[model samples]
Target: MRVITVEEHFHHPEVGPRVMDLSGPPPIDLDADFSTFWRNFTPDRELAEQLAGGRLEHMDAAGINIQVLSHGAMTPGSLDHPDATGLCRQVNDWLAEQISQYPTRFRGFATVPLYDPKAAADEMRRCIDELGFVGTLTQGTFAGLFLDDPRFEPVLAAAEELNSPLYVHPGIPPASVLRAYYSGNWPASVEFLLSSPAFGWHAEAGIHILRLILSGALDRHPGLKLLSGHWGEMVAGWLDRLDEAIGWGHYLDRPVSDYYRTQVWITPSGMYSHNQLKFFLAEVGADRIIHSEDFPYVVRTNVADFLLNADIADHEREAIAHRNAEALLRISPL
Candidate 1:
């Protein structure tokens, strides 16, 4: 199978440290082995910084033919930093340079400074038109304001005009939300995990996409395409309920699920469960599904085996493996 993973990540070693630090307090739990957990789960920094040799070798070992790389944890800094315009430009330039080195084995997703809508739009244009990036990635929200906030219209407009899909990766919840909702239930370690990857992050990304639909952002920018990780950030399972509940209000031009059908795409992001594959295939169909490993952070034992052995037709497997990504991101198939 010609596998093309779209949610792989890269960290710009030189530029990462300069961004403002918004990461909240470290885990203070005394009960859980937080240190050991992170030690095992944290991605290797050297591997993340190496675009040519180390990463490529790992891909070869795992049978990944292509990786669509985007900035990882530091991605939100582009929107939070005071000098985001310059920082985002530098970040995108460096990523473009890296992709140029392994043009066929690698692809890029632009990192834009969503804090400045006009600058974000210009950078998205430059990355897609000039740098040859397939699209852009956003780490959910910036300064607690989701993209549906009217201030981000220019970025949405640019995405539509440029025909670029915005990959909505999960971002850390703001401090206030962290304190109010996710804290106090258990050990700080559990709280931290709950507020992030274990639960909060996916919920936040799902809400972000729904806000784009409900807040009229998608209606205004109808041509804009959205890519969500972790099986549409849990939205794939809830579309029916969402459409049912939102139908009571009936605010938009169509049902909430219609936007998902037309404008959204989803990837497993390393959640390689056959049950999930079966459910998502039934819920959204094969066309809306794509492939990803969520790389380094989510290193699966059976990297390619899940899709390779899916209980589906050959064409469906091919679509999830590479064809859907090729069509969505305009990547040329090998």
Candidate 2:
């Protein structure tokens, strides 16, 4: 099977310093930087080489045929950062450069400088129309403001018109949550900081997509396609209840699950829980499922083995491995 993994990630080494230069003082994330996690996850030298070099050989070894590259998690700054547009351009250019050298084995997700919505929409158009990008990845929010903010509607409209799906990744919970709630020690900050990537991250991403749903972005931009990782970021299986709660106040244009089923796509993202996959498949069906590995951050395992060995029917497994990605991404079958 040809494997086309989305959510493969890379980082520009200079991104931090540049964002700091333009973003004024950085957030707490910059100071603490979660070095403890990133250090062990990617390390420095090998990750640098992976970003600077190529991963075709590694993909071949692992039976991953292609990777749609995205910025690691969220882009590391507020959208209000003064140089957000420039930083976005630099990131997108670098992504395009990396993919250009290995077009057959890689694809690019454009970054839009979203501090300025007009500029972001324009950039989205350029990246897709001119740069041949597959789509763009916007993490949970630009700072705390979800993309459902009216300012960002143009970007959503542009994404739909251009046929570029928007992949919404997770972002950090507020610093207030970290400071007052999750601060310090095993049951608190330590566990939150560690487990957030697994559980908390999914909740945050789910909420963000939920905002897109309840905030009526999906209703306005009916053609919009939203992608989320970790089995639809906890939204896939619980649609009936989600709609039930939301519908208590006012009727939505459609049920929350209907919007989700039509507008959202999910990926496994190196999270290899057999039960989770089966449950997710049952909830969301196989059409909205796609392949992902979360790349260097979770690089030890082979996703191909998960696809081949997971307790799923052959056709469903084939869809998750590559067929769905091919249709969603508009790529020719190998």
Candidate 3:
């Protein structure tokens, strides 16, 4: 079966380092597993910036026929740089060039300057219509506010109008959230992990989805396509609770779970847990589940094997592996 993984990430050669604080010193002397797995984890930065020669080889090794690349956690969209709008155009132009090199094996998700909603919407349109990008990705929050904030409606409206899916990637928490919840009681490295990949990042992403639902963004833009990774960022497991509890005082046109089922698509994002996959398959159905490796971060090369051995029917497996992504993202099948 052909495998297409979304949620694959890469770093922009120039703009990435300038905005994302990539020069921090590595943390040392911690628990072996946490330190080795996360704290000491260093991705191949050169390979991250490479496409034709480097990333394609890794994709072949892992049996991924195509990868939809997007800027990772700290995307230009989440920053407050003075030249953010120009930087976003530059980044998307670079990404479009890379995808043009191997249009079959590589696709792109545009990086928008979310700090300015109108400019972000314009960039998103240019990416989809002119550059042939599949969609746009909004990384976490902008100025500590999630997409549900009224200021972000223009981008949301553009997405609905363009029939493009918006991939919601996690981002670093606001300082207040970091200090209040993830600090104190651990080393700085541990605190950083706590605020990021360990727990906070997923929760932050999940909360944004809930806010969109409760705040009626989904209701207003009912045709919006919101994609979530990490198996819907823990929201898939709690749909029942969210619907049941929030249902009591709900004022929306539909139930919370209904919006999830209709509007949201979920990917595992390299967390290869069979139980989680099974739960999502039941909760959201196979049509809503897509495959992703979160490449260079998780780096599990046995992706084909994992999906092939999954305890699902052949049709369902096909849907998760490539069919769903092709349908949702409009990729041509091999």
- All candidates' lDDT scores? 0.85, 0.78, 0.86
Which runs in model 2 stand beyond 4 Å of their true positions?
20-38, 41-45, 48-54, 73-79, 184-195
lDDT (Cα, tens digit) per residue for candidate 1, span 17-126: 56634433432334557677767766898778878777888888888989999988766434565577787788888988888888889899998887788989999999
Stretches off by above 4 angstroms in model 1 are 20-40, 76-78
Model 3 spans > 4 angstroms off: 21-39
Residue range 186-290, candidate 3, lDDT tens digits: 676778788888999899999989899999898899889999999999898899998888878767677789999999999999999888888889999999999
Model 2 quality (TM-score): 0.90
Clashes per model (N, Cα, C within 3 A)? 0, 0, 0
Q: Per-residue lDDT of 1-334 in model 2, one digit per residue for the tens?
A: 8888999887776775566565453234433545655556553444533543436656877788888887774474245676788888888887788778777888888888778888888888888888888898887567568888898888898999988899998866666554554455444335455436746667878888999998889988888999999888878878989888988977687889999998899998888888988888888898889989887777635779888888889999899988988888887897
Clashing pairs in 2: none
Q: How many residue-pair clashes does candidate 3 contain?
A: 0
Colliding residue pairs in candidate 1: none
Q: Judge candidate 2 against the unseen true structure and give its global Cα lDDT, from 0 to 1.
A: 0.78
Quote the lDDT for 279 in model 2.
88
State the displacement of the C-alpha of residue 15, model 2, in Å, after optimal TM-score superposition. 2.6
